[model samples]
Target: MRRGDEFAAAIRRGNRAGRPTLVAHLQVREDVAEPPLVGFVVSRAVGGAVVRNRVKRRLRHLMRDRLHRLPRGSLLVVRANPPAASARSEHLAAELDVALDRLLRRRGPDHQARTDGRV
Candidate 1:
C-alpha cells in the first residue's frame, strides 16, 4: 500500500467497480497476516491539491469503518473521480458501499467461500 508498485499491481490484477464519484479496484491475497490494506488515489484530474486532499480524507474516513467487512489480506484501491471533489461524505460512503458490493458480487463464489471459512 505504501509503494507505487503495489497500487499498480492491484489495479492491474484486481476486479473493478466504478461510480460517478469513485472507481474501486480490489484483489485478494492469501499471504497477508494483518488487516486488509486500502489505498486512495486522487489525481490532479480530480482537482487541485486542496480538493484532492479533501476527497482523499473523505474517502479514507468512509473506508475506515468498512475495512473489517472485507476479507483478510485483501488489497483495495479507491480512485476518486472529478465529481468526488464536490460530493458529500454520505454520498461518497453510499457509492463506496455500492461499488464494493458490485466488486464482491462479481467474485461471488470466492467471496462466499471465504465467509463460510471454506477458503
Candidate 2:
C-alpha cells in the first residue's frame, strides 16, 4: 500500500517485539480489516538514499518470500537499525527472517491462549 499517515501511525502505535537481529514494533487492530501487509521505516539516519533504497529492496524481496507464511490480518512495520543499513541482501534476509519468526511465534501462542479461553 502507498505510504500514508494512517500507515505511519499504526507503526507508531504497534507493539514492540524484538529479536537479536532486528527489533520490531507492531500494532494489530481490527479497524484494519485487511490481512497481513507490511510497511517499512528507514530514515536518513540509517544512511544515504542509495543505502536506504538498497535496504528497502532487500526487505521487500524478503517480505515477498515470507508474506504467505505470515499470519493473516496483521499490519507489520519493520524498522531497520544502523547495522542493518549496510548489510548484504542475504544478511538482511536472514535478520528479517529471525525478526518475523519471533513475531509469528509470539502471536501464535497469544492467539492460542485467547482461543482456548474462549472455548
Candidate 3:
C-alpha cells in the first residue's frame, strides 16, 4: 500500500466514492491471498505537515475500526480532502462510515463470495 504502484493500481482500477472530507478507492484482488491493505493520502493541499499528519492519524484510527469489514485481499486508498484538515473527528468518522458503506456494498457477490468472512 505504501508503494506508488499499489496506490496507482487502486486508484486506476478500483471502485471510487467521495465525500466532503475524503475520497476512497477500493480494488479487490482475488489472487492476493492476503488480508486487506489500506493506505492514506494527505496532500499538502489539505494542509501543512502537522495538519496532514493529524488527518492521516485520524483516518487511520477511523479505518482501523472498520478494517475487519473489508473482504480479504482488498486494497483501499483514502485521500483526504482539504475539509478533512479542519473537520472534527466525529465528522470525519461519519463521512468515512458513509464512504465505506457505499464502497463495500458495491463490491458485489463475485468479490464477496469468498470463504473468508466478508460482507
Candidate 4:
C-alpha cells in the first residue's frame, strides 16, 4: 500500500463511500495474504503539514482499532476531505464506520466486496 500503483489499483478497482469528513475505498483481493493493508491520503486541500499529519494520525489510530472488521486481504485507502482537518476523532470514527458499512453492504455474505465503485 506504500506504492502509488497499489493505491491507484485499489482506487480504480475498489468500492468507495464518501462522507463529509473522509472517503474510504475498499478492494478485496483473494490473492493477497491475511492481514489487510491500509493506506492514507491527506491532500493540501485539507490543511498544512501539521494539520494533515494530525488528521492522518487520528485516522491511523482509528483504523488500527477497526482493521479486524475489514475482510482479509483487502486494500483500504482512507482519504481525508477538507473538513477532516478540523473534525473530531469521534466524528471521523463515526464517518468511517458508516462508510465501511455502506461499502460492505454492497458485497454479499461471501465477503467478496464489489469492485465497480458503486454505492
Candidate 2 lDDT, 1-97, residue by residue in tens = 4567646765677666665435665555544446666788778877999988887777778888776654445667877777777677788777777
lDDT of each: 0.84, 0.66, 0.88, 0.85
Better of 1 and 2 by lDDT: 1
Per-structure clash totals for the candidates = 0, 5, 0, 0
Q: Which model is ahead, 3 or 4, in terms of TM-score?
A: 3
**Tens-digit lDDT track of model 3 for 1-119:** 78999899999999999998899999888777688889999999998999999999999999888888787888899999999998999999999989887887797766555524353
Top candidate (TM-score): 3
Any runs in candidate 3 off by more than 4 Å, and if so which?
Answer: 109-119
lDDT score at residue 12, model 2, on the 0-100 scale: 76
Candidate 2: Cα lDDT at 115: 19
RMSD of each: 2.3, 4.6, 2.1, 4.8
Model 4 per-residue lDDT tens digits across residues 30-107: 676666789999999999999999999999999888877777778899999999988888899999999988887877
Q: Looking at model 1, report the run of 10 residues with the lowest lDDT sum.
A: 110-119
Q: Alpha carbon lDDT of residue 12, candidate 1?
A: 97
Model 1 over residues 60-100: C-alpha lDDT tens digits? 98988787667777789999999999898889999999998
